[model samples]
Target: MKAILIEKPGDESCMKLGETAPPALTPGSVRIRNVACGVNRADLLQRQGFYPPPAGASPILGLECAGRIAEAAADVTSFRAGERVIALLPGGGYAEESVVDAGSVLRLPDALDFETGAGAIETLLTVFLNVFQLGGLPSGGTVLVHGGGSGIGTTTIDLVKRAGGRVVATVGSDEKARRCRELGADAVANYRSEDWVEVAKQATGGRGVDVVLDSIGGSYLDGNLRALAEDGRLVLIGLMGGAKAELPLGALLSRRLSVIGSTLRTRSPSAKAAIVTAFQARFGADFAAGRIRPVIHRVFPLAEAPEAHRMLKASTHFGKVVLRVRDDER
Candidate 1:
């Protein structure tokens, strides 16, 4: 098997591709001949000596992958060998093959190609779980998504709009704002040039939004609070800006607002499986129904995983960047 191994955390140049033994499948786990994998920002942070793979996880960098089941453990009953599936990984997605708990392996919708499936689990799970499950996004609610051109951002825009919510998005430039509008955002604000909270307020007719899905932490944390309506929920998924921030405690109390943080990669297997199951039961039909679809901006071959990481860091892409492990996987 070929894998991208990070001998030590450093710059993007540190990711090295070399031959490695394939991991053997364990009880309740399945071996996947990886067809595709998604490049996540956390992968870059990990390589730069910031984020580390959780305990007991593979040292490799990928967070989600789509592939065929080469072997299914005896303890697994619902899935079998040769099934096309997408699975969430605690780590080790940046390889030719990987293993995952069967409970985390989801059958790919026939309508989806492997590249799309490969990029699905991580961003979609993060958005669905935080925005809807934890953030309490309601049907007919007004929703604001920061970093709207990001993979998770675009996914949130699609899900919220399809669920009957009005979408407002904040982006860095005019180009991303255009993409956000095309993706069903009722309004788009250029966060780099304008005050997004004001734009959000105007878009919502001065009532503010019912929910805010924010990834950039730090100073934006206070702004997120300002953008929310009374009883609004603010879900923080990343602190791309910085970890520490001056929060508006008075506003939080006065408006009865809620702020919750989420990270899918570090969650326990049972927690990941619970979200997989919950999404399967509720939004699975959306995939087949054509309401929610994977949005991939670019696809790079597996060996060029470093380039994929660079692309993600550039923040030029409007949606997900997926690595094509094998063109025939679909």
Candidate 2:
């Protein structure tokens, strides 16, 4: 099989299309002939040797893909060969095929194309797991989301609105702020030129929000706490802005705040399966009905994975950047 191979852990120039052995199918897993795959910031980190795949997992960079089941383990009864599906992978999605745990695969809705499926599954599961499950965002409650124009940010805004909650999104530019509002954010703040903590509090009448969905990590920790209402939860999912910070134990105790750190990549298969099940139960219908979808900023071919990485690194995109592995007729 041909894949985007990394000659070394470095810049985009290190990647190139090359041949490699196809992955062997494992029990309780399915082999997918990938049509498309989603590009994520984690991929870039992995390429630069900052992140490594978990033990016994594929060393490939992609985390999610959309495709058809080329084969399925006999124990997997819910899905069969030739079924359209999207899967959350531990790795190995940047290829012609990927073998994934059966429990992590979702049937791709007919309403969506392969590219959309590729783009939506990862971000949807990430946001659902962090903002709703871990953060415990109540219906009609308000949440402050940092990096509002990101794939996770846009997905969070859509999901929160559908769940009857409010969103205050913080973006780096005015255009991103406008897009966030159009995507259902109740309020949008240009973090580059505005005080996001103030905007978050003012959006909820100075009471602050019930949750703070943050990806910026350390640099935003103090501000995230200030943006949250009493008893609010701060769900940290990424470390885009460095990872070390001093915790103000006094404020945390006084405000009764909870801080949670989460990541989907290193989770056990069973744990990931549970998250997938919960996401399907809650939002599967919404996706099948075309009521919600991922916002795609661009799509590149499989061989151009290097270019995709460059674009994501530049942070100029508003949503997901996808790689088309093969043409989809339907």
Candidate 3:
């Protein structure tokens, strides 16, 4: 099988398309002949040696993929060979094939193509778990989303709107702010020029947002708290900025605020499966109905995984970047 291999932990130059042994099918899992895969920031961090795959996970670089099931273990009855599907993987998605736990697999909607399916599962599941499940965003609630042009940000805006909530997004440039607005964000703030905390408050009539979905970590911690309404929740999914920060205990106590940290990659298989099930139950119909879809910024051939990493690291893309594993006629 062809897979993206890293020669060392460094720059994009470290990655290369190379041949490797195919993964063995495991019980409770299904092997997929991957058609496309989604590239994520975690892949970059792993490439640079800052993040390592969890124990027993594939050392390969991708997090999500779309393809047809090649084989299913005896214990896995929900999927069968030749069925179209998308999977959230622990790793190994940057390849011609992937073997993943059956619980993490979902049938790809007829309305979507493989490229969109590759991009959708990870971002959609991430947002759904953090914003709605963990953050407890109520119906008609307003939430603040950082990195408005990112895959996670774009998905957050779309899901919040579809769920009868509003979004106030923070971006780094005017173009991203405009794009966020087009994606159903009720308000947008260019963090490079405007105070996003103020924008979040204003967008919610000065009461602040009910939830804040932030990935910036330390640098935005104080501001994220300020942007939230009383009893609001701040969900942190990434630490792109520095990791260490001091929490304002007084403010937290007085306002009854909550800070919750989450990551999908390091979770147990059962936990991940539960999240997948919840996401499917909540939004699967929306996908089939075309009410929500992944916003793909670019698609690269599997051989060009290095270039895909470069684009993601440069932070120029709006929404997900995908890798085409093969051209499936179906």
Better candidate by TM-score, 1 or 2: 2
lDDT at residue 198 of model 1 (Cα atoms): 93
lDDT of each: 0.86, 0.91, 0.93
Which RMSD values do the candidates have, in order? 1.3, 1.0, 1.0
Maximum-lDDT candidate: 3
Model 1 scores a C-alpha lDDT of 0.86
Clash pairs, model 1 backbone = none
Error of 3 at 114 (Å): 0.5
- Comparing candidate 1 with candidate 3, which one achieves the higher lDDT? 3
Tens digit per residue, CA lDDT, model 3, 224-302 = 9999999999999999987999999999999999999999999988999999878878987888676689999999998
Model 2, 1-330: lDDT tens digits are: 878888789999998888899999989999999999999999999999999999988888899999999998888888999999999998999999999899899988888889988998889999999888999998899989888998999999999999999999999899999899899999999988999999988899999999998888999999999888999999998899989999999989999999999999999999999998898789878987878889999999999999999998888999999999876544
Question: Could you estimate the TM-score for every candidate?
Answer: 0.97, 0.98, 0.98
